[model samples]
Structure formats: structure tokens, C-alpha cells
Target: MKKLQILAGLYLLCSSSTWAVEPVVSAANIQEIRLSLDSVWVVLGGILVFFMQAGFALIESGSVRSKNTINVLMKNYMDACLGGLVFWLIGFGLMFGVNQTGWIGTSYFAPNEMDGWHWNLLFFQMMFAATATTIASGAMAERIHFVAYIVSAAVVSGLIYPIFGAWAWGSLFDGEGWLKALGFIDFAGSTVVHSIGGWVALAGIIVLGPRLGRFGRNGQVHYLAGHNLPLVALGGFILWLAWFGFNAASTVKAEVSIGRIALNTHLAACASAVVYMVYTLIRGKAILMRGTINASLGGLVAITAGCATMSPLFAVMSGAFAGILVSILPVLMEKLRLDDVVDAVTVHGFCGAWGTLAAGLFFEGRMFNSEIIAVQILGIMAAFIWGFGVAFIVFKVLDKVLGGLRVSKQHEQRGLDYTEHAELSYPEFQHDVTFETDDMTKRH
Candidate 1:
């Protein structure tokens, strides 16, 4: 009886071991299992987000005149392909695979040559590099040369983007970088990536000036309406879908994965679409889907930096407010005589800042041992300064050396397809292609 009791006690102890902090199971096997599962999902997310590039190309092309469709398509394709190469060679090292320095990431080329997590980190960051490059394409659409754009993509992804990303993330220092000390926390990069892209778009627009005949002699704005609404809405939806990857992937840990991240992202996006539609209805642009789409994008951008730190309720509120900003900011930009073809700056830039700041106002918990309000502000300011400064210089240099950023007014009227590509976007409409020396649409 005594021997049997002792044996039973031993069995009980062994069973309870399962609940202990340390596991008797092999750690190596567990690590491999975790890596295999996480990597597949992460890459799949990237693939979905990559599809957004296609959506962007189609929407951008369809919205513009038939003459500019092929031009826009080429830019989008080139940015992703070449942008990948650039990020692979240099940008990844600077953004994530570096030595964790604050000023700039130390590695410039071949960051994944080292063993361990280097390769996965590089792959994830490469996607963001492509995204940043494409943002500029939309802003500079209808005129930027393919050759010039290729160079810009290389420089932006390989150098410009990586440096800023390093600064924004705590990778700037082993302990506390300036922004880290300030308590700035961008969960995913509303300010760091999208806002920076927006700032660059602003600079490009300023340097390139308005599209030819976009404004009248009396300083009146002209209407350069997009050719297709369906395509625009499709692009917006694709972007919304990809956003799940963009925000959720920011957690960067198997342990951190939770329902909170996804719920916050979805709620914010929903609130944004509704709010923008309502705001635009009140503003009298209710008939147009462009406002609704852009507003949703704005909401997504606004929630990016705050998503992980905010509750679902606050995220929805923040997104609704951002939708209003997205709906109205473009009109304001038009009033100031800036011709942003796809509303890239308003959607990415304006909303990025708002989203970053919203975290400060609405953040309810601590996720990374940082203060939400201060960190959010610092991140926004950092993005604005770095993005605006570098973009201004790049635009100025390109404009000066390239002999004006836009084509001659005569070429603008002739259609970029014939002048730049020596081809027509749609051969069926070639016979009716009308060339003019002035704006085709009436002034607004």
C-alpha cells in the first residue's frame, strides 16, 4: 500500500510540471515551430499588401486621362520591382538589420548576410520600402520621367527611408534615443512612413509646380477630374485589406499577437469610412466616392501609430476624426494651388500626423514601457522634419539638373502617351484623341 501511494504521488508531480514556467519540452523544436508558422503568415500578409501596389496602379491610371494611364502603370511597377532591390541592397540594413543605432542604421548593404533573424527582418522591411517609393509616384504622376523616377525610388528606399525609420524606432540607441526619451511611440508608422511619404509628396508638388493649366489667369482652380470612380473605390478597398498586415505585423512578436490589434484596426477603418462619408455629405461632395475612399484611407493612416496602444473604442473615434481630415484636406490643398493627382499627401501625410497625435490624446495603456502622448508627438515632429527636409533637397536637385520637373505646357496638352511613350493607352479611342494647348476641363 505504501509503495503504491508513493508511485501515485510521483505521477501527480510529473503532470503538474506541464503548468510550470519552464517547459520540459525541447526549446529548439518550439522555436522552429514558432518561426515556421509566424514567417508564413507574415509573408502572406506582405503578399496581400503587395497586391495593393496593383490596386494603386490601376486606380491611378484609371482616374487620370487615358494619355497618362500607361505612364502611371509603369511608375507603379518600376517602383515596386526596383524598390525591392534597393531595399534589399541597402534600405533593410538601415531600417531594421542595423546595429541598433539612433542617428542612422549602420548597415547599408547586404544586412541579411548574417545568420538568425536577419533575413526575416530584411524581407518585412522591404515591403515598406516599396510602399514609400510608390507613394511618391502618385504625387508626381502625369509628368515625372520613368528614368528620373527609377533613380528617385532607389535613393528613397535605399537611403532616405531607412535613415528615418531607424530614428523613429528605438533602434536609434541601446538605451534611450532622443525620441525614445521623449516617449514617442509609433506602433506601426503612421508618422514614420506614411507621413514621411506625404511630406515628400508635398515637396515634389512644390518643386514640380501644378499640372499644366491646372489654374487660370484669374487664379481660379481648374477641374482635372479622374476618369473612373469604380477603379478608385477598388484601390481604396485593396488598401484597406492590406492594412491588416501593415498594422498587425507591427507587433513583431509571437507573444504579442492578440485580438486587440486586429479589432482596433478594423474598428478604426469602419469609423473612418462612415465619418468621411457623412462629413463630405455635409460639405456637399456626397455624390463623389473619392471622398469616401480617401476618408477611409485617412482613418487607416490615423490609427496606424495608435492601433496597438489604443482600445477598440478610442480607435474608432480616432478613425472617424481622421476621416474628416482626409475628406477636407485635399480641398484645402487645391485652394493653395497644389495639384496632388491622387490625394496622396492628404491621405497619407495629413492623416499620418493626426493618427500619430491621436495616440497622445487617446492612448489608454502601456504596451512598450513608454508614454503614448509624448512619444506620439515626437514621432510626428521627427517624421515631418526629416521627410520635409530630405524631400525638399531631393526635389530641388532633380528639378535643377533635369531641366524642369514637368514637361513643356505644349506637351501637357498633347497627351503624355504620344509624347512620352509614343503609344496610346486605348487604341480604340486613338482616332478621337484630341490634342489641346490649354486645360481640357472647365475651371471649378
Candidate 2:
């Protein structure tokens, strides 16, 4: 009887101790029911952002002279491929690896925490990184040599972006630093992605200088046109469709607001397209085909900073204004000695800055934290200062080493499609069409 009582007491004590303990998990097990749905949505949305590369490729090829079409396509493809490896090596780790303190990340580059619960969300982020770097290519097209471009693209994807990203998204850095204390919110990277790309474009343009005959000796502007307009329009349409994914996916999870975000994106894009087409009709004799397409893109960039915060009405207004700005800014840039071959700065940088500020002005409080606007502004400055500063230094160094970023003026007149590349974009047309017809048939 004594032994039996002792054993029973011991069992009770052990059972009670075991019951008091609860299992702990490291991160939120978003691997579960509701989060699973959210995961699917985010991953799919990211895929759409990836598809924008095709849109970018089409737009670039169509906007440039025919001889440079294949070259542009090649550059786009290589950016994705090279950018992917760069992301895996250290970029993702730097961006997401550290704790919440916020200055920079400390850990996440490996494959273990890299693959589950997402289509590799890290991988999806990598695609965005690539797109940002690639945007500079079009703006600097027909002038930059291929080897110089490869180095620039690799450096951007590998180092320039990730470091700044850590400041915005790194919990460790943001938590401990000025950025977090100031309540900086960049929900989808208005300045981080678009502005960085714009700054790089600016650097390249400054370093490359004007294309041959782009400016007369008297300082007036000259036209060195594109090869195809229809293709550019088609590319623009594809980008319009894809932006839905870019802005929406930044949520990182499906929530009640995803629907609102999608709506805002669509409305802004629609408003931009209409407003630009109208502006073109009023200004130019016929539709300035490419300008309207670029204007639509500007609206999309402007909306990215606050798709979730602003009303659909504000989105429309924001987009319309951005469209006008994009449609008109290129002439101003030319006047100022900046050569943006595809106007990447206006579409990405200028519109991006405007969109971020719009969030401060128009965000609906009940829908979003009012603090987001201030945060967005801070983010824009951060992106611009860092992006422009770093690129300026890089381009200056490259210019010193490589004798400027542009091909020789002789190469420009001969056509990069035939001279630098030594491959004819249209040998048959060159043989059959008179110079006038060739110029008329071209999209530029």
C-alpha cells in the first residue's frame, strides 16, 4: 500500500510539470490554414511582377532602332539570370537576414529558410531587383557598350540595392535606427525600386552624354528615332496588366486590403492612359504613340507608394497628374542637357517621388496608418540620395576607366545595329528603302 501511494504521487507530479509547458515556434507558423491562403495569393502576385520583364523587353526593343532590338533582348535576359545569382549569394541575406534592429541584416542567405511556405519569396524579390537594374538599360540604350553594361548591371543587383533595402526592411536596422523611430513606411518600395532605377539611369545618361546628332551645334534638340511603335504599345499594355501584381504582391499576405489595392492600381492606370492620350491629341498633330504609353507607366509608378492607403478617386487623380508629368517631362530633360533615351527618369523617378508624396496627402486613415505618408516621404529621400549618389560615383569611375559611357559619335551615326554590334537589324530594308522611307517607316 505504501509503495503504491508513492508511485501514484510521483506520476501526478510529473504529469503536472509536463502539462505546464507549452511548445514554442520561431517565426509565426504562417505555414498554417489562413496564412496558407495568403501565401498562395502573395506568390501568385509575385509571379505577375516577374512577367513585367517581358513587358520591359518589348518596350525597350520597340523603342530603340531596329539594329539594337536583339541586343536589348539579350541584356534583359542576362539581367534576370545574373541578378538571380547575385540575390542568392548575398542580396537576400543582407535584406532579410538580420534581426529587427534595422541598420542592416545579419543572416538569411542560405537555402534552408529560403524555400518553404513560398515560391521562394526571396526568389520573387530577386526578380524585382533585376527589373529595377534593367530599367536603366533602356534609358541608356544605343550608346552603352555591352561589356560596360554587364558590369553595371551586376554591381547594381549585387550590392547597391540590397544595402539600402536592409535599412528599410531590416527589423534589426529599422528597430534600432532613425528610420524606424521616424515611422518610415515603404509598403511596396516606391523609392527603393523605382527611384533607384531612375538614379542609375541618370548616372548613365550623364556619363554617356548625347547620342550622335541628338543635339545640334546650336544646342537645339534633334531626333534619332525608334524602330517600332506597335511593339512598344503592346509592351506598355503588358506592363499595365502586370503592375496589378507588383503593387498587390508587396502585401506579402492576402488580407482584406488586397482587393482594394488591385482596384486602386487599375483605376490609376486607366486614368493615366486616358489623360495622356487626350493630352497628346491636344499637343501633337497625330497621336504621339510612344509618349502616351510612357505616360501610362508613370501613373503606375506613382500609385505604388500608397495603393492601399489612398481612395480609388485619389488614385485616379494621382495617375492623371503623373501621366501629364511623364508626357511633358522629357522635353524639359532635353532642355536641361539630360539624355533619357526612353525617359526612364520621368516614369520611374519623378513619378515615383510624386506618388510617395501623394500618399502623405491623400491616404485614407481608416484604411491605413496616417504615419505611412511621412514614412513614405523619408523613404523617397533615402532612395534618391543613396541611388543617385552611389551611381554618380560609379559612373564617374567607369568613365575615367572606359573613356565615357557612350560609343563613339561615328558609331551612333552608322547605327549601333550595324556598327558596334556588326549585325544588321534590317539588311533587306537597308537595301530596298530610300533613306526617307526608312526614316518614315521607323517608329522613333
Candidate 3:
């Protein structure tokens, strides 16, 4: 009887202890857990997107000549550092601040007080601002003065990108964007990010002019092949992996829908790559590695706006069209005497517009709603005007105020790595060669 009583007492004590510690499954508890999970997901996505800076560095460095490799890498590095700082100081507020007018954000500049969710959102968006600024880096590679490039990056991150972003994504906070109010759906910023970058790149290249010797006096185009194709390929793969987070994380939730978004993103990229490869083969041209890599990126950009809303079949269709566009737009750019070193204008600018259109064209169950497409078109036009027109004026002013945007012709012939940075990417290979007075000898 005594043993039985002792055992019963112990069991009751344990039960009472468990009851005391057990979590109550209340709505508040569940909501808190949901918030935590979503915050974590957004942070992870931001980290992935941040890694894209390395991808850009590799791609831009490999695309330029050996002499200019270090210069390209430096620009990409500064873009992340400087661009992130400016976005935090000014851009974030202008993009996500509370406003009644909706033209721009009126608060949140250099935000100091915010909850965990706001911090996570700012971190994620800072990566996007860096990305938009870096797009102009590759297009202006080899010739742009380092100081000028840095200034341009700051302006874009702090002003141009944020203002346009406010007009489209302002509702992310307390303000409502005019475009968003019109039912313009950019699930992941095809126009707001990529197209804006592309437009800035277009403006930059127009002001900088083509690299010397890129076009002969007779108007024949000379191809300046990338020094390291393998690096370009590797960079392409990195960007490909990063894009999943780029598109899916825009949902800002840890939900089942991320699976579908990721699947659509993958399908679009693969379809576009295959289509570009096949097109090259059918045309009897050698399979160009860079073209195919860019084709995949074009598709990724195209699907970003619609990844959340698009079905797999339509994703493929959008990617296929992007492949075609990527194939032809480079040729068109060359014909126009506009020199884009990495074809950033076509891959990001034109393809981003197409992707924005695809979002409306393939909206599930509402395919090709005229009103939605019209809204999308309006958004596209606004991005172009704001992004390109403003950037053009900025670059032109910078060009004159800074003395020149391009390096001296003498410095250009000697390679920017030596003239700009006093460093050489392949110094060991140049021990036997001597730079002549005329600077005519090409540094291999």
C-alpha cells in the first residue's frame, strides 16, 4: 500500500510539472511561430541573393581582357560595398517609406528603430539595390573611370532605383504605388530591378561610346572575345542558383507556393538554354558557350516577374521566346553601333520587359486579360523613361564634371588594370614584354 501510494504521488507530480511547462496552442503562439519562420526564410533568401555579387564579379572579370580583369573585379566589389551603403542611407526610405501620395516614400530614411521583420526586409532589399547598381558595371567595363563608376553606382542605388521601385513596390510598406494600384503584377521585379539596371546600362554605354577598335573605320565589327570562358560559365551557374532565391523569396513567406515558384524558374531557365543551343545548331554556327549562358540568364530574368503566377508550360514558352530574343538582340545592338560589353542591355532590358508582359499574358485562368497587359505595358514604359532618361542625364553630367568618363586613349591601349589600379591580373606572363611609347602593343 505504501509503495503504491509513493508511485502514484510521483506520477501525479510529473504530470503536474508537464502541464505547467506545456505550450498552449493559442492563435497568438501560432502567429508568432509563423512570423519567425517567414523571417528566417527571407533572411536565407537574402543571403543567396547577396552571393550573386561574386557571380557578377566572375562574369565581368572573365568577359574583359586580361589587362582589365582587375579593374572589372574592383568595380563589382565596390558596387556591393558602396551601393549597399547608399541604399541603406537613402534608397530604402524612398522605396518603402510610408506615404499617402505614393510617388515616393516619405519616411524610413536611415532607419534606426524597426522590428525584426523590418530589418530582414531591409537586408533583403539592400541586396537587390546592389544588384541593380552592378548591372551597369559590366556594360561600362574596360574604359569607365573608377571614380565615375562609383559615383554612378551611388546615384542609381540612392535615387534612380529607389524612385522607380517606389512607384511599383511602395505598397510593400505603407504607401501604394501607382503601378501596383493599376493591378500591375511584378511578382519579383522583372522591370523594377533587371529592366531598370538594363536601362541604366544602355544610357551608360551611349555616353561612354564603344571601346576603341570595337568598330573599324569601315564600320565592320570586331569581336573582343572574353579572356576566360570557363569563368563566365561558372558565373552563369552561380547566378542560376541564386535566381531561385531571387524569385521565390519575393513571396516573403515560408509557404508551399515556393515549390511551384522554384519549379517554374528552373523550367524556364532550362527551356531557354536548350532553345538557344538548338537555334545555334540549326543555324550551322558553332555552339557558342557565352551565348548559351546568356540565354539561360535571359530566361531566368523573363520568368522572374511571373514565376509565382505562371504554370510550367507557360514558363517554358516565356523562356523559349527569351531565348530567341537573346539570340537576335545582340546582333541588333551591334548594328546600331551601340557597344554593350556583356549585352546587359538586351539580356536585362528587353528580356525584363518581355517577362513583365508574360506575367500578365500568362496569369493563371485570366490568360491575356487586355487590362492587365495594358497595365504591364504602362509599367514597362515608365521604367524605361525613368531609368534610361534620368540615367542618361546623370552620366552625361558626370562625364563633363569629372573631366571624362572613359580612360585616356593612351591608358585604354595600355589596359585599365595597369593605368587605373596599378595591378595586373597576369603579371607573370608579362615579364618579357615591354610597353612601347606608342602603347600599340596589345597586352595578351
Candidate 4:
């Protein structure tokens, strides 16, 4: 009986010991697990955003004439490589470092010693900086000097993008931005990323002037058809897929709300695409492949700011409006004598502004709050002023310093692929074909 009593006592002691230790061990491990999960999600999000570079490259290459295909591809590639390097060295600091009077980041330049979490966030943001820089690559595709474009990309990635980003997103790190303090709600950078990119692209095209024959002496608009519709469609699909990560991962946490965000994104894109096709039909025109693709993208940009906060119905409405904007803005650009190769300004700039306003106008449970709408308008104006104004000045200075931002007439006629890079996307085709000074070649 005494032996039995002793065995029971030992059993209880062992069980009690495990109960005590298990809670302590499990608590520590649960914290670690949460950290690991969050880190993985963030890294995955960065990877998805990085893949967007491929989409940009394919879309831009296909949108340009075959003669300039190689040059466009090269520029997009460098936008990620060279632009990423500059953002890492300087932009990251100016964007996410300690706040300096609610205007800029003051530390973390060329960061090397940040903790793992900070590093992950930096990687994600670096991809965003590269994205903003690449928007101009499409708009400035054919005429821009390769060297000049490279310099501009570095400046934008390292300075303009990050500085504005600091004003709106400084609190992401150790800083606080005035926009955030004013309760501006650009949840996923419709203004900070897309509008900023679009504005810079507008400045670039304005400085570079229209491509030869884009506008006639009598102001007639000429069409510059893309060489490869298949590539354009593929790129659009890829962007659509990657955008799930773009909107959902902005949460930076593994949470239930991601499902809603993803659904909203999908619905908005679909609504915009359908609306674009119908609008084209109503205009007595066949649905254009490029217009449809761009309309979907515009919708995605429009809903990005409000995806988290908007009901799916409102998401659809915002996307439909963006589709209308996509349909009409190209006409306006042509009327204004602007030659935007891929309509980057309309898709990203105007759509981004609309999305920001929608974020407030459609805020769940706080719909049409006047103060919020005003704040959104202020953010939109700030983006245009800083993004377009500074970029215009910088491009003008570069144009003067570099002699000009566009290629020589002869070089432009021969095609940038041959003149700029001594390479050809279609080597089988002869390069001696004469291009008209006032119109694109029949083959194009």
C-alpha cells in the first residue's frame, strides 16, 4: 500500500511538472510561431511584387513597335536592377527612417543592422519603389535617351518617390508623416505609389515630346499599334494575378481580412473589364484588346486604396467608374497632344486619385464623411503637386544638361534597339527599311 502511495505521488509530481513547463514552453513557442508566420507572409508579398517587374517588361515591350522592343525591355530590366540598388542605398532611408518634422526620414540610410522584421519590410518597400520608377519606362519608351532614362530612374527611386512616400507613410517605420496625422487613408498606396508613378510618367513624356508622327501637323492623332497582342494579354493576366498579393499583403499580417481584400480586388477588376468592353460597344466600336486590358488595370488601381474598407458592391462601382475613365482619358490625352505609349497617366494617375477619393466616399460605416473626403482630396492634390511639379523640373534640368532627353532624328528613325543597344528583337528582319518622317512604317 505504501509503495502504491509513493507511485501515485511520483505520477502526480511528473504530471504537475509537465503542466507547469508546457505552458511556459508553449507560450514562448506560440510567440515565435506568430513571428515566423508574419515574416514569411511579408517575404512572400515582396516576391509577388517583384514578379510585377516581369509584367511591366512584357507589357511595355509588346506595346512598342518591334523596332524598339529590345530597348523597352532593357529599360524595364534596368528599372528593377538599377532602381532597386538606388532605393536600397538612399530611398529606403528617406521613406522609412526616423521622422524629420513630418517631412522626411532622417536615418537608416543604407541600412545594415536592422532586425529581421525591419529587413523584411524594407524588402517589400524596395519593390514598391522600383514599381513607381518603372511606370515612366512605358510612357517614355521610344524616344527617351537610354542614358537619360537611367539617370532619371535613379533620381526618382532615390529621391522623389521616397520623399513623398515619407510624407504619407513615414509611420510605417520610426517616422510620422503629416498626411497620416491628418487621417489621410491611402491604405495601400493608390496615391503614394500609383499616382506618384503616373505623375512622373506624365512629366517624362511632356519633357520628351511626342514620338515622331504621333501627332500630325494638323493635329490628327495617329495610332501606334503594338507588335504582339499575345504578350500584352499575358502581361495583363500576370499583373492581375500578382495584384492579389499587392492588396492582400499590405496588411503585413496573417489575418482573416485578407480574404475580403482579395475578393474585393477580384470583383473590382472584373467589373472594370466588363464595363470597358460594354462602353466600347456602346461607342459603336469593337472591344479593343489593349483598351480592355488597361481598363482592368485601372480598376485594380482604383480599388486598391479602398479594398480593405469597401463592401464588394462599392468596389464594383469604383471599378466601373475607373473603366469609364480609362475609356475617355486616352481621347483627352490625344486631344491634349500628349503621347502616352501605354496610357500610364490615365491608368495609374487619374485612377489612383479616384481610388483615394473612393476610399473616403465609400468608407464602411463612415460613408461620405466630409472631413475624410477633404483629407483625401488634399492627399490627391499633394501627390500631383509634388510628383508632377518636381519631376517636371528635374526632367527639364536633365534635358538641358544632357543636350536633350530624346534621341537624334536619325537614331529614332533607325529604331532604338539598333541605335541605342546595337541589338534587335527580330534579327531576321532587315534594318534598312526606310521609315517615314511623318508616319509609322506600314509594317508597324
Candidate 5:
């Protein structure tokens, strides 16, 4: 009986010890929990950013003539599809790969043994790559051949975009980069993504030239209005909604910083919109709807590079500055006879540059840093040179290889909807229509 009692006591003691230890083991690991939350937050943000493609499609299609609506939609769709496939295949490797000489990435191709966390990072970045490529679609719309656009999308996502991205944002996870060392801080890629995309768009529009009838023989510029204001407004709203994710979620972790970033983004966008409206009204002109939308977008772009670094007041100032640029830059481009279909250059390129500089100047408490601004300018110049210069050569080569980047005169007149795709956006309406000479519209 004594032996039996002793054995039972030993078993009971061992069971209690095991039960006590299990709770300690299961106690929340703060680091692991934080990482998991970050992953979920970033992935959700990526989905929101992904939806911006729809917004782009609506914006471009609504802005262009109805005859070319289907063509613009296809280009937007292709931007996402081609960007995803190519970025997964090579861009991710190039952007976040092992650093080689601090210029570009060298690793992360599919089928490799990568951590799950790295894959999550890649998914988030793929959306950014797609967005960079899609921005050019609006500028090059109505004129670019489908095949040529495909090539452009592939090259931008696979090479041009990734290479520049590596220069600035490659160190997001690990490894040092030259740009970061030079104190070029783009918190969320105003120059890295927007400027690069904008420069590429600029190159494309320059190469493709103004759409037919956009300018007259006497050097008069004509206005080409979008087909639907309501659709344009919808697109703008969608973009504004997604931008919260774009800026706040860029924090990569659920923290107090996210709220600040969100607030800054919202304030900047609102300030830009209100300022643009007032600016236009003061110029003895009615509030321009397109100007308002572009101003909001420009403000968002402006804040992206500095969203994390700037306070809300500074963010508003940056956005207001961007709003001014958005309102005036397009007009200046038109005066120069440079036709940008949707002011992609003004909103993304110019405002993106300003935003980068603003971040350097208004870096929270720092207020003024000449060194930082110099670095910012260096980044901006590099982006323009690399993005615009490479795209120019690529488009030039593609033009020769594909016979031309622009559609035949006949196709442009008839509209790319019928020429590029046999389907029409509104098949019920007569497809055999041409733009009205008095107004930029199609009539049977």
C-alpha cells in the first residue's frame, strides 16, 4: 500500500508540472504576434491597392473617347496581369534580391526556398509594380498598339521599375543600398514608384506625340474632355479610399504610427482638393471637376514619400503645393505642345518630385535639411533619367520592330475599340461613329 501511494503521488506531481509548463509555452510571444499582425495588415493593404486598378480603368476609359474605352480597359487589365507574372518571375528578385554593388537586387525567383514572410512581402510589392506600369497607360492611351503596350508593361515591371526600386526601397527588409546611404528617404515611393512611372509616361507621350486633332495647324491647343464626369468622380473616390491603405498600411505593422500616417494622408488629400477648388474659382473660372480629381491624386502622390515622416500640418502644405502643380503643370505642358492624356506627368512626375523634396524639408521635427533635399533631388533626377531615358529607347526600338507605336491613322480616326478589340464598350450604340469636330465626341 505504501508503494502504491508513492507511485500515484509521483504521477500526480508530473501531471501538474506538465500542465503548469504548457501555459508558459503557450503564452503570447509578442514578437511573433506582432509579425503575424503585420503580415495580415500588409496583405489587406495590398488587396486595397490592387483594387486601384479598377479605379484606373474607370478613370482612363471615362477620360478617353468612348470609341477607345475598350482599348484603355484592356491596357489597365494587362498592366495588372503582366505586372504580376513578370514581377513574380524576375522583378521581385531584382528589387529585393541580394544586393550587388548597391545598384540592383540579385535573388527571390519563384520555386526557390524562401521564407513565407518573404513571399508575403513579394505579394505586397507586386501590387506596387503593377501600379507603376499602369500609370503610363493613361498617358499612352488611344494611340499605343496593343502589342506594343504589352511589351512596355512587361519591360517596366520586369526591368525598369525593379531596378530603380532596388536603388531606393531594396533595403526595406535587409541589405544596404547606395541611395539609402546617401540619405535619400522615400518612405513609400513618391519618386521610386510615381516619378519613375510618370517619367515613363512622359517618354511614351513624347514618342507617340499628341493624339490626332489635339493640336491645330495654327498651333492652337484643343481641349479633349472625358466621356463621363460621374465615372471620373467615382474613380477619384475609389483612389482616395485605397490611398489610406497605400500610406497607412505601408507601416507594415499595426502600430500607433499607422493612425498618424492615415491622418496625414487624409488631411493632405482634403487640403489639396479644397485648395485646388479655391485656386480655380479665384482664377475667374468655375471649379473644374477634372482639376479637382487630379489635385486630390497629386496630393496623395506628394504625401506618399513623406507620409511617415511629416506631421499633418506639413502634409497639408505638401499636398497644397502639389495641388497647385496639378492645376498648372498640365496647362504648361499643353502650352509646350506636349500632350499628356490625363496629366499623368503633372500629377505623378512633377508632384512626386515636389513631395520628395518636401519630405526632406519638413521631416517632422527636422524642418530643414539641405543635405536631405539634395539627396532627394538626386533621386528625382536619377528617376527621370533612368525611367524616361530607358523608356524612350525601349519605345523607339519597339516602334521600329512593331512598325510603329501609334495606331494607323485610319484606326485612330475609327477608334481603337473596333481596331484593337472587335468588342465595343457600348455595343448597342452604333459603332460606326466619328468624333464631332465641334466637341470631342462621337456621333452616328
Candidate 6:
């Protein structure tokens, strides 16, 4: 009897202790679980976006001349590193800080916020800031001074990109900005990021002028072929993969709707590729690899603003239009005597505007109305004017202060790889390399 009582007492004690220390995980705790999941999803999404920096680097290096490959690679590296650091120090504060009379941000500079969700948001936005500045790299490639490029990258990430971002998405989580108050809807920054990058690229190119051999006498346009098509295609695929995170992660929550966002993004890209390829075939022309890649990217840009707002079918429609837009805009720019080295203006700028407008046309739960369309147009035009105008001033000022943005004739002929970095991308093939300078007889 004594042994039985002792054993029963010990069992009861242990059972009571277990019940007291551990709560049951059930439906009652779902809210907390959901919050944790949301944070995890957001962080993962941010990580995926960071991988796009590699994609940009590959695309840019492959698209330029072989002799300038190293220069392009270095510029891209600086864009992510310097841009991310500057964004963390000042850009994040200006973008997501407390509003100052609905104009700009005033707080969060050098942030020490420890909230997991807030940090996740910061990471995601930092990637976006880096991307915006990097877009200018391809446009100004081959001839720009490294120091000047760094300065321009800093300016865009620290001030121009963030301030505009504040006006549109500063209140993304639960705040309000002037544009948001005006009912502007940019689901994932088509107008805010890509269009801004595009406009800025245009400004820099205009200031820098055409590459030496790009235009011939009598207004003839010469085509400068990219060094590596395989790398370009590979880069495109990587960007396409990254975009799933870009569009889906914008939800900022782990929910079923994320599936829809990702699906829409995929559909849009596919439709765009098909349309571009068909358009080329119908015109009795061989489908160009670079054009198809750019068209796919244009489709991705177009769907970014409306991915969450439109049906999958509408996504297809939007992407088809973007494919057509990217195709024609390049020709239009060339006709104006503007040489955009990689067609960033058309793929990002023109398509970005169209994507924003397409959202107004197809958004669910919002009645098709002139007011919404007008607001969308207003935002697009605002981005174009501000992005282009400010970038122009910045470049022109840098040109004067830095003793001109383009390199000398001698350096240009020798290639930026040798002139700017004093390194060759392919040193083993030195004999095959061509130098256009009169000093060719001189020893290296």
C-alpha cells in the first residue's frame, strides 16, 4: 500500500508539472503562428531579390564589348555594395521615415530598429534601391569614369530614388503618402522602381552621348553585337526566377493569395515571350535572342504593378501589350538619334508606365473609371519628369565637376577593360584583340 501510494504521488506530480509548463498548440494559437509565418516569408523573399544582383551583373557584362567586361562587372559590384550601404544609412530613413508635410521622410536614418518584421521590410527595400541605381550602369557603360559612376549611384540610392519612393510607397504597410492618398496603386513598384531607373538611364545616356562607333556619317546607326549570347539568356532565366519572389513576396504574408500573385507573374512573362516570338516570325524575320529576352523582361515589368489586382487572363493581356511596346520603343529611340546601349529605356520605362496603366484597366473590385486611370497616368508622368530631370542635372553636374563623363579618344580605342581597370578579360587571347590607336606599333 505504501509503495503504491508513493508511485501514484510521483506520477501525479510529474503530470501536473507537464500541464503547467506547456500550452496546447491548437486553433487558439493560429494568429501567433500566422504572424511568424508572414515574417519568414518576407525574409525569404528579400533573400531571393538579393540574387538578382548577380543576374544584372551577368547580363550587363555579356551585353557589352568583350574588352569592357571587367569594367561592367566592377560597376555592378559597386552598385550593390555602395548602393546598399547608402540606402541603409540615409535612403531607408528618407523613404520610410515619418512624413514631413507629405513631402519627404525625417526619421529612421541609420536605423537601429530591432523588430524582425521591420528589418525584413528594410532588407527588401534595400534590394530595390540597389536595383534602381544599377539600371543606370548598362546605359553609361564602356566609357564612364569609375568615380563618377560611384557618385551617381550614391545620389540615386540616397536621395532621388528614396524620396520618390516615399511619395508613393512610404506608407506601404500602414501609412499614407500624397500619392497613396490620391488613390495611386503600385502593387510592387513598377512606376516607383523600374520607370525611375529607366528615366535616369535615359538622362545619363543623353549626357554621355553615343559610344564612338555606334553612329556613322549620314546618320547611319551601327549595331554593336554583344559578346556572349549564352550568358545573356542565362541571366534572363535567373531574373525570371527571381521575379517570383519579387511579385509574390509583395504580399508580405504567407497566404494562399501568394500563389495567385506568382502564377500571374509567370503567365505574364510566358505570354510576352510568345507574343514577341510570334511577332518576329510574322514579319518574316528570324527571332532574335536578345529581343526575346528583353520582351520577357518587359512583360515582367508590366505585370509588377497589377499582379495582385488583375486576373490571370488579364495578366496575359497586359504582358502581350508590353511585348509589343518593348519591340517598338527601341526603334523609336534610335530614330530620335538617342543610343540606349541595352534598351533599358524601352524595356523598363515605357513598359513600366504601361503596366501601371494596365492595372487601372483590369483591377478587380475597382470599377473601371476615368479617375483611376488619370491618377495612374499622373503618377507615371510624375516619375518620368522627376526621374529624368533630376538625373540629367546630376549627370551634367558630374560631367563638369569630374572633367567629363566619357573617357578620352585614346582610352576609348583601347577599351575600358585596359584603360579603366588596366586588366583584360581574356589575357590569353591577347594576340587576337584589336586596338584602333596609332600607337599600335608601340610595345605594351
Model 6 over residues 1-444: C-alpha lDDT tens digits? 999999999889978856576557877688789988998998888888878788888888889989889999999898889999999999998888887456678888888865767898999899889888888888778878888999999999998899889888885344556787798888998889899999999998999888888888788989888798888898899989988888899898888999889999999988888898988888888889999999999999999999999999999999999989877788888778787777888888889999999999888877477899999999998899889999999999999998998899777767888777767788777435644344443435
Which order, best to worst by TM-score?
4, 3, 5, 6, 1, 2
TM-score of each candidate? 0.87, 0.84, 0.93, 0.93, 0.91, 0.91
Q: Show where candidate 1 strays beyond 4 Å.
A: 1-25, 97-101, 170-178, 254-258, 366-372, 432-444
- For model 4, residues 219-266, the per-residue Cα lDDT tens digits are 899998989989999999988888888889899988899999999999
Error of model 5, residue 275, in angstroms:
1.2
Candidate 3, residues 1-444: lDDT per residue as tens digits?
999999999889978855577556888989999999999999999998998889888888999888889999999899889999899999999999985687898889999998889999999999999888999899889899999999999999999999988889884567587877788888988899999999999999999999998998998999988799999999999999999889899999999999999999999999889999999889999888899989999999999999999799999999999999999999999998899999999989999999999999999989999999999999999999999999999999999999998899888978887777766788787432316333323432
Each candidate's lDDT (Cα)? 0.76, 0.77, 0.91, 0.90, 0.87, 0.86
RMSD of 2: 8.7
Model 3's lDDT to the true fold?
A: 0.91
List model 5 lDDT by residue over 322-431, tens digit each: 98898788888988899888899998899999989998999977778788888988999899999999999999999999999999999898888877776567766734
Clashes of 5: 1
RMSD in Å for all candidates? 6.1, 8.7, 3.8, 4.3, 5.6, 4.4
| Tens digits of lDDT, candidate 1, 1-444 | 999999999888878957567656698988888987677666766776677787778668767877777778888888888889878877766665445435655643665345555455566677777887788788878776667667777888887788777676635214333565456767787887789888888888888888876889788998788777787888888888888888887665544654688788888888988987776678776446777777778888889988887888899998998888877788799889999998989988888899888877876754334456656766777788888888888777877888766777766776676666666677577545745323333211
Top-down lDDT ranking: 3, 4, 5, 6, 2, 1
CA lDDT of 283 in candidate 4? 86
- Candidate with best lDDT: 3
Alpha carbon deviation, residue 404, candidate 3 (Å) = 0.8
User: What does the lDDT read for residue 355 in candidate 5?
Assistant: 89
Angstrom error at residue 2, model 6:
29
The TM-score of candidate 2 is 0.84
Q: 5 or 6: which has the higher lDDT?
A: 5
